[model samples]
Target: MKNVTFYLDFVSPYAYLAFHALPQALEGCSYRMEYRPIVLGAVFKANAVPSPAQQPAKRDWIRRHTTWLAEQAGLTSFAPAVNHPFSSIPLSRMALACSEDGAINRYVANAVFAHCWEAGGADPLDLQRLEALRAVLHKQWQPTIQSVDDEAIKQRLRANTDAALATGLFGVPSFVVDGELLWGLDALPMLRARLLG
Candidate 1:
């Protein structure tokens, strides 16, 4: 089976779109995906660039583009986060807290993504919403909810971010297959071709 490393941050709309599109995009491919949650702001800083959201016009364009992309992909539930460039650190740590090693559980990743994108653009970091999420996750795995604040989980997220940069990945929704880096939701077709070959 082919191995794919999926790097994402919940703040990225492209990541949200790509996450939901992956299943069908490569339907018959034999692959295993390892999800890596990273602090996208760190990546921007390291790359000496500003987030698109920091640019008014580019941010607006992406908001529209991703919305249209979602509709085209038949993702009826997709919605932008109310805070486009909100701190993804807490959610990333929360996700890692539930993870084993550096590979996050797909279920946990999905839950986080849905929390960011599916709640009518609500802020995922809002106390009430986070508490609700904590409650839901508590039922799924008791330890997960409790571990989000652990120092180890926070460090792991940092390590993952460092690792991503070392591997030359600079954006969300990136896929690494056979050591080749592919970025963006638009890379799915190239990823499919790579996987099929």
Candidate 2:
């Protein structure tokens, strides 16, 4: 199977879009997705770039684009996040905490995105949100709350972000397949073709 490395941040609406789109795109392809959590802020800082939300027009555009894409993708359940560019630090840590040897890690990651992304401006790290995340993981896998604060998890996420930048990833929803970088949710078809042909 072709291996696809998914670089994701829960705060990214595009990443949320890819959460639903890529699976459909690669339905028949022989591929394995390896999900990793990275700090988008770290990526921006490493590149000395400002986040799109920092600009008024770009922020507005993202709002519209994500909403429209969600509808086109038949994901009407998705709404443009009202509070974008929210701090993803805690959510990233939760993803790292969810990491394991099997697919439940992906479940935990997606659950975090599902829980927080739709609310727009919702605080993902609030006590209530944290407990909700805990519930999601605990439902299937036993996750220690301390895992979020583990030094190994911290280093792991930091390394993931650095590795992503090394691969020329400048944004979320990036797929690195066989050393090829495909950026954005719109790049799903390219990834699908790579897996198919």
Candidate 3:
């Protein structure tokens, strides 16, 4: 079986878009999807890359295109939050913790993406919204919340971010298959083709 490791952060609109399209894109492939949560802000800082929303032209283009792509993918319409580049530290850490428990991580990752992108939450930093996601997952929120700042957990987030960078990934929604790197939701078709081939 092929393995596709997906490196993404909860705050990325592109990642949000990819989440909706990926399942269908890889439908016929015998691939395992490994959802890796990383701190986008940390990666941005390390690479000196600005968020798309920070650049006016790119921000406007992403907003328009994201909506169009979502509609095309039959997903609910999406508009990235104004203060996007939201702090993903807590959400990322929680995702890492969930990963330790097996398949729950995928469920939590999907829930977080839906919570932020579909539910129109301002940011994952919003305690109420985070709590709402926890309720949906039927997991205790405080333990996850409290674990975010733990040194070991923080280290894991850093390691994931560094691993992403090492994979030659410059952005979110990157998929890695047998050392092949595919970035962006637009790259999914290519990834599928490669896997199928």
Instruction: Point to the candidate with the largest TM-score.
Output: 1
Which of the numbered candidates is closest to the native, going by highest lDDT? 1
Q: After aligning candidate 2 to the native by TM-score, how far in Å is the CA of 7 from where it should be?
A: 0.5
Question: Judged by lDDT relative to the true structure, which candidate is superior, 2 or 3?
Answer: 2
Q: Model 1 off-target regions past 4 Å? A: 139-145
Worst 10 residues of 3 by lDDT: 96-105
The residue pairs found clashing in candidate 3 are none
lDDT of all the models against the reference? 0.86, 0.78, 0.75
Model 3: residues with Cα > 4 Å off, grouped in runs: 101-104, 138-146
Worst 10 residues of 1 by lDDT: 137-146
Error of 2 at 187 (Å): 0.9
Residues 1-197 of candidate 3 have per-residue lDDT tens digits of 99788888888888988887887888978988888888777677778987776798987787788878888877864656766666777777666655552222567778878777776636656788776765676563335435556666677777778888898888888889999899998898999998998
Residue pairs in collision within model 2: 82-120, 83-120, 83-121
Tens-place lDDT digits, model 2, residues 1-197: 99889998888888988987776788989988888888898888888999998799999998888888888988766765566767787777766666653122567777888877655556666788788787777655435446667776677788888889999999998999999999988788888888787
TM-score of each model, in listed order: 0.94, 0.90, 0.87
